[model samples]
Target: MKILYINAMGPYEAWPQAGVFVSERVAALRKNGVDVTACSYYQINSPAVQRVVTRNGGPDLGTPIAQQAGVTYGIRKIPNGFFSAAMQRFRPNFWEKRIARQVRRDMEESKADLIHLHWIWPMGLGVMRYCRETGVPYVLTCHGGDIYSDMKDMRKRPYILKMLEGAAAVEFVSKALLESAKELGYSGKNAAVVYNGIRTSVFYPARQEHPGKTVVGFAGVMILRKGIDYLPEIFRRIQELIPGEIHFYMIGSGVLREEIEKKMAGLPVDFLGTIPSEKLAERFNEMDILLLPSRQEGYGCVIKEAQACGAVPIGRDVDGIREAVDGFGSLIAYTGDDDAFISAFAEETAAYVSGEKPIDRAAMEAQAARCSWEERQKDSIAIYQRILGKAD
Candidate 1:
């Protein structure tokens, strides 16, 4: 079956680690002999648009049909905000009508068996409208922000609700998010919880190279929400308490990088900036433990990826991480509880180093296996086939 995975976001080269997971999952599906196409609205204006694409790695729209794992992708040169922009200037009636007509044309040419949408908002809703017009089956996977943040946006909600109403199935990464969706008027029958999966083969546990200095690693967007700002103090307290060498390895960069650098000024922390996701396991092999004190998370892929590589993760107990970790490594206080986090950081790192409780490679591989792209793609393919075979 031909499937079109629709999203609006980024220059695939700069995609976040999670984007790598999604891309690999789609690649896995294609390897299983499924026809998959992607429509990424990459390089769009607006912070919301960027967040979606950045989170999902706008697929390689420039990929040739063969290079794209039997998938073709395109970037819409026309941004989706002309109507809202024109609304401020003059009557938006003509522009609004034109958008509907153009959306219909795009859908017909694509001719997808199923439209699997990620991040249902203004752009996603357009896909929903086309599905409704053509009586095509569509599914939406909510990855936060779109539903939780923009649900109240006037133009956004109507489309979100329409998408919800028309979707053959709806998926959220977390139970909290699923609950949020139910509360937000999504009463679809096939509403289900599907956790994001990872590539365990590429991200399996590795042998530790450093046994002398206790290394605490972190990877993800270096934004305030990730609790990167508190790393300086956390490391300082760790150094003082342990009185041993405590090295910090931070990966990824964002708006908070400059400010975080200012805060950590002369500290012993090693900021590697952003490295490709494929290289993370190598760093994981070097590190003693992974730290992700994020204020929020959606399946904490880094936590899983690190754990898969035998780097025990110390994360803030919230949403996806709480569910993903499931008593694996250390669970600290929510991002606000700095004191508790510092205390836990030292204790956990010590335990990890002294072999009090080493990361269980067998258990981690087992857990990681449950969330693999191969497994997820199987379920996804089933979801598509079921949707297609359903009575219209």
Candidate 2:
């Protein structure tokens, strides 16, 4: 089957980590003998876009663009400068039209049997319109931000609902996300809960030799949505209880890094800015515990990544996170309750440090196995086949 995958940003663009996930999914589908082509807009101001412009001539309008792995990319340059900034601030639809025109051109050239849209914001409206007009089937996947934030905007809700109404199938990364869509009055057909998976080959367990030290770590974007601001107080309480026995490591970067550092001043925390994917397994293995205190998570893929390396995850008891840590790790209080969260962290840390509670390497591995890319691929392929009326 010829399939077209549409996303806002992937590996070589604005969000490289998300691009890695998309690359893995495409690789898995190709391995199963499916023909998949991916298309993404050129993310303005991203390092990857800068590199592309430096190496190749900037993207041309209405042309078949670059290729990565086996997937073809259609790159379009959006309007820049003061006028573009005004359009973005006053009329976001101006940008969506450019996205739609490019996507329509790409779809016409590829003649794909199906389209799978990754997120439902600017891209979805355009792609869904093209699919509706051209009589092609497309599936929409709500990957966190669209459902959590974009859908909350009154101006965007109608467009979002129209996309859902037009899609052949709608996939959510977690059950919590599916419920959120429903609560927003999305009475769509053929909805499914498909959790994001980890590449086990890259994220599996390793033998660590850190002796006499319990390392608690946080991995992912250090943004407010991640509840990173609360880390300082939590760490302070942990240190007050078990000084010198525990150490903190944060493995990622974002806008709030400086503020987080300021709050965590004089603490035992080490900021290990962003680590590459190749070395992530080693970092995960180094941690005795991985903390994911997200205020709102779609599906914390890092939770599974850390667990694959045998780092027990302790996360907030919120939507998608609660499910990710259900059978594998500990769930503390909700995002804002610092006292309850601190109490839970201190208790769990004390138990692990004192040898009263042991890290179950076997159990963590088992959970990771269930959430691996191979398993996710199986579900995704089945969804594709079902949508195509080719299911056995």
Best by lDDT: 2
Runs in model 2 deviating more than 4 A are 12-15, 43-74, 80-92, 390-392
Alpha-carbon runs more than 4 Å astray in model 1: 12-18, 46-72, 80-106, 152-155, 335-337, 355-359
Assess each prediction's global lDDT (C-alpha) against the native: 0.67, 0.75
**Candidate 1 TM-score, true structure as reference:** 0.83
Best by TM-score: 2
Residue-level lDDT tens digits of model 2 in 130-242: 77777778888887889989998887787788888778888898999988988897985679887778877778878585777778889888788898887887778777776
Model 1, residue pairs in steric clash:
9-53
Cα lDDT tens digits, model 1, 1-392, are 88776654333444333245446656787878887666654323345544554577432233212112233456554443544554624431223344345556656776767777777655554666666777777788877667667775554565567667778888777776777767777675677777777777777766666646777778987766687876877777666755466688888877677778788877788888777656777888777778787776767877777777777788887777788787788787754566876777767667767777666667865686567777777777777778888744
